[model samples]
Target: MNKLLEGKRLLITGAARGLGLDFARRACAAGARVVMADILDELVTEEARALAEQGHDATAVRLDLADPDAIDAVAKFAGETLGAVDGLVNCGAIATGIGGPDMCELELDTWDRVATVNVRGTWLMSRAMVPYLAASGRGRIVNIASDTALWGAPRLMAYVASKGAVISMSRSMARELGPKNICVNTLCPGLTLCEATEYVPQDRHDLYVNGRAIAREQVPEDVTGSVLYLLSDLAGFVTGQTLPVNGGFVFN
Candidate 1:
């Protein structure tokens, strides 16, 4: 209800559906201009159009996180179209059709794919957009990570490794960019019920949710508040940290 992000330009990845889409909607509701980019161009465009019809400042673009050129082009377009971006939410990721390889049975191509999109994609996107964010004078980067990485889940070895890399990279970026007034942090969510989690085996899902302290399943919206906080001015001093939205699934 509060326009906490008024006039801020935010570029969110994987915003066609799920948590990314939820973040875009909430950010716009809070008075921020939003650019929703996803690999699913049609869905993202439709979403953006719907939001625009509701009088929100929103736009959509096709972005493949696994591709370097696509990341570059989208960053450029976002800068030119939305002006200087104040926030970047790295929510774009491949999980269902991409991860779950056992470490011993993992293929090189699979490892590469996960690393490229999850790790490299986050890097490329941040690198490409740093200039615009710097221009804003109060840039914020919220990277979507996973609790699996912190607790060391099995069978999803590659994904865990990639997310571990994400957490590490966020800390390093935060330190390096601190002088520029940019805050970089990781938003680690527990096993959430989304299209991406459908690929996770039922047993694995149970392991994540059944024993959780909250006694409830995690949803996209459950993590939105933490994201909004990290991207808001309130979190100006909260950099190089991992904020877990895991319902006590994994304590710090």
Candidate 2:
């Protein structure tokens, strides 16, 4: 590893497993001190401990992205223990199960929950950590978005709306934080094969796979490199951009 993030402190949300975990592992390998947080406290702790045992500077925290209080508490804890955060990867999200509901049929509660975690959570997490990021002088933020937002997939209205909000929010944040040298960008991944995606309908999965130019399913690792790049010094001049890592599923 080139240690692109040497001495950097990163706080990644939804890192118990899947793509978030993959990002933590890669960031640590690149010499970052990582704070991996998730709603699943036990899993996050165990994963962090395992990484620590391997000589990685890793810590785990219980974080409920939907709760504003929890977001504040986690931010404070991270700032106190890890010093200023140089990077934040907002990878936390929620998916609407297939055949659940359409836009007109979608329940308000379900929409609220998805938006709370996927959209509001990203906003709150980034808001809470901005002070710390600003203090670092080289802050980097990578918000996880989805290709559905770009293509306007049917049936998954709430999820698509939430991710669309994330992409818009990232661009606004990037513009606002540019003066502080804080790079804010969005990473939109297609129908990736992860634990969360298991709930997606088979027809939907097939649609993504067969329609992709590459005709290959995406793995969690496929998105980590773009994230790593955005968080490194190499991306200092990049901001307010949405980088899709979806294997050509949706082209700009």
Candidate 3:
């Protein structure tokens, strides 16, 4: 009932389902107008419509992170449509399935694709929105990384590498945009039990859960509170830091 994000306009990428959709829901609940962007157009449209039906100001945009032009276009569209975007949550990335072969057996295309979408896409989308966010005066960028990045997981080399890049980029972007009043930070969540992560091996799931300090399954909801805090005014002074939403599995 506090409406932490009141008067804010935010855009979320990869919002078709999973954590991104959860983020959209939480943002709307926090009193922010949300523009959900994802490559899955129809699904994201339904997501946006559902939020609207609930009396929340929400819209959906079809965005492909692989396309530089599409990334820029979507950021522009968000600003024009929402009047101004106060924040952006970079959650879009290629869902490289879990338990792939080791790096030696990993295909070149697989590695490249993950890096392109996860690392480059995050950089470009943040770049495209810089001007508009700066204009908002209290602009915020929350880049979604992974706990895998914090603690290197052997089987997911590409994903771990890509997420590591996201965390590094967040720090650099924070310094670059800080003068303009834009804050950039990275969120590293553990192996959350979401639709996309259902394919993860049970042992891998247990590895995260059992290793966590709290020893419980992580969920989308578990990650939302930190995300909301990062996007709200409470985190205005926070930037260039890696905040883990995992159950104390990894530290800063």
Candidate 4:
């Protein structure tokens, strides 16, 4: 809102809908040019076009995190389209319908799939984008982890495990990328009311609301502010940090 990101160029993954979409919109509104990448090609394209109509610099490209080659291509396209990347929001993951199966009941394939998309995907995407970020001189990387990783939510071991890995990876990346002036951090969000979380049982949602210090259902906005700050100059000195924005549901 304060043009904090003016002239910044960013790449946001999983931006077709949900929190990723909101991040893209808020970044654009804050005066940044962005490339929105997702597996939902058509929807991301439409969303980017709408942002363009609103006088924002935005573009859409399909990115399948499961494919390393696809990740490389999208990284290339985003750098080309934006001319340079000042920040990357790694918000894409296999979150929908990946619940219900307990650790013992969870199939091996399901675990692999979640790791492939959530863990490996985040790593690869970050790997692909580091160059553009290095060129920016003041780059930022925001990896979207989950509060479930901290709380150890049951019956969702794969997703929870992958998010934990993300948090660990971000810390390592911060250490490795610090010399390059790129800040890497992780945001652990609570059970947000989004399209992806629609399958989560109402009982679990109630549990989150009741346990939260704020005593309200989490939304995309609750987490987006942390994202903005991490990507802003104010947070340039901060890296390898984990911020849990789950209404005090869990502390780091």
What would the TM-scores of all predictions be? 0.96, 0.97, 0.98, 0.98
- State the lDDT at 251 in candidate 3: 75
Model 2 lDDT, residue 242, Cα: 92
Better of 1 and 2 by lDDT: 2
Candidate 1 versus truth, CA RMSD in Å, comes to: 1.5
- List, residue by residue over 68-183, the lDDT tens digit for candidate 4: 99999999998888876899999999853534866778888888999999999999999999999999999999999999999998888988999999999999999999999999
- Considering TM-score, which of the candidate structures 2 and 3 is the better prediction for this target? 3
Q: After aligning candidate 4 to the native by TM-score, how far in Å is the CA of 25 from where it should be?
A: 0.6
Question: Mind giving the per-residue lDDT tens digits that candidate 3 earns over 1-252?
Answer: 359999799999999999999999989998999999999999999999999999999999999999999999999999898876799999998757778889899889999999999999999999999888988999999999998988899878999999999999899999999999999999999999888897899989888888889999998999998999999989999999999989989977
Q: Model 3 clash pairs?
A: none
Instruction: Go through the candidates in order and give each one's C-alpha lDDT.
Output: 0.90, 0.92, 0.92, 0.92
State how far residue 181 of model 3 sits from its true place (Å). Answer: 0.3
Off by over 4 Å in 1: 96-101
Clash total of candidate 4:
0
lDDT over C-alpha atoms for residue 249 of model 1: 87
lDDT of 2 by residue, 15-39 (tens): 9988999999999999999999999
Query: Can you give the lDDT of residue 248 in candidate 3?
Result: 86
In Å, residue 6's CA in model 2 sits off its true spot by 1.8
Off by over 4 Å in 3: none
